[model samples]
Target: MPELPEVEAVCRKLRRDALGASIVQLRVERPSVTRPQDPAHLESETPGRRIESIERRGKNILIHLSAGHILHIHLRMTGNLYVIPDVRFRPSLARLWIELDGGRGLIFEDSRVLGKVHLHPAAHLARVLKDVGIEPLSSAFTLDNFTRAAKASSQPSKIFLMDQRRVAGLGNIYAAEALFRARVNPRQSARSISKPKLANLHTAIQDILHHAVSSADAAYAEPGHFAEGESFPCAVYDREGEPCTICGKPIRRIAQGGRSTYFCPRCQR
Candidate 1:
């Protein structure tokens, strides 16, 4: 699954290329995608609407429409959106295509078939995404706020970070990066972190994520061309058995809350 940065990259591309485009064609090659809309209902609701803007909320993409509706997309694992010139362009294995004005199209291709698309009002969607926690990048999330949120959960530091209801958009990769940067063990209790260290953690999380976003932008020629930022984008996520970038110690891996967490055991904590 693409984390916050990857989703942000996708949103930037969608906004630049697909925004303000009319939905001239709504092609559903895979019946499973529109199953929620149902063929008849989906056809009635999708066409003729113009995309006004595209924005990211946590890991979801909100495609604003002029018709008082929004198309919400969650590119759950292996899903990506493509924009190309040819009208003949279809999903290489695309399950859905929304044709914009002219020959441009927003194609949703998912090899794993786990991605989802739904149409709803911006007002009504709060119910679906309300449980998601604060955007760490948002102005509202602060050091004090992070401490309060983390202290509320006595769970492992990794668990506290991974909980979307506690801190939004943190996946294992960035979680590992942030914890390693904090020099705190992933298994430490969230409540045990001191104010200064927690402050470091707050700074570390934002810094690491911001570094990744900038690195990703620099690493790709176009935002639409992001190849694989998630496979291993930083210090410890996939550096297991390799020398730690900071301390030269062998990186290690462990399973936490069903996700594999990578860290420099000797340096962390």
Candidate 2:
């Protein structure tokens, strides 16, 4: 469950480090790791084509190619991307590798078999992502729609946030963090939240995600201190019995929608 911030970090690395590169060769150990098109077709189309720009739609990383194709990476759980100049120094559990002109390459390393890579023409990208909801950071995610969607559901606020169909890119970690930031209990009814709190929740979601992305960028720019696979210090997530950052009370965990939510009862309620 690499959330929006994590995905954003990977895309930034791809843009800054992997762009302007040429693919000399490719190897796929796990075909399911990425959808297999004709390698011959990709070899002809990808090589000599520049990586024009990098963008993200929802949780998907779109690597825009000069050939009018987009190499999309959906890093599912336990999926990691490594950009290394030495094939010998590549990370473990590599599913695929795209060798560049030099020694550099984009390595798709994932222990879990959940990650997926897809190549699509530029003309079909919009259609491919048409079902995704407006990005939470975008201006299109108005408060009205946010509130209306939440109210329309009988699910808990925590559960509603995890619904990818209603809102894209929010996973367990972010949902818990944003709920703590908004001071909303995870078990509370979505429609029961007050208007002022709803607004606060919206702002909290945006602020937390923005801050996370900023920290991710800082980590990417300086990878020495950016320990790979490191997660940010969270207020509630993964801290089952830890002390609340805001209050002295202990953080609690409850199972909802078959997922565990960590929060401080005092702080969130």
Best-matching candidate per TM-score: 1
- Weakest ten-residue segment in model 2 by summed lDDT: 223-232
Clashing pairs in 2: none
The residue pairs in collision within model 1 are 91-94
Count clashing pairs, candidate 2.
Answer: 0
C-alpha lDDT of candidate 1 relative to the true structure: 0.80
The per-candidate count of clashes, in order, stands at: 1, 0
TM agreement with the true structure for every prediction: 0.92, 0.89
Taking all chains together, the TM-score of candidate 2 against the true structure is 0.89
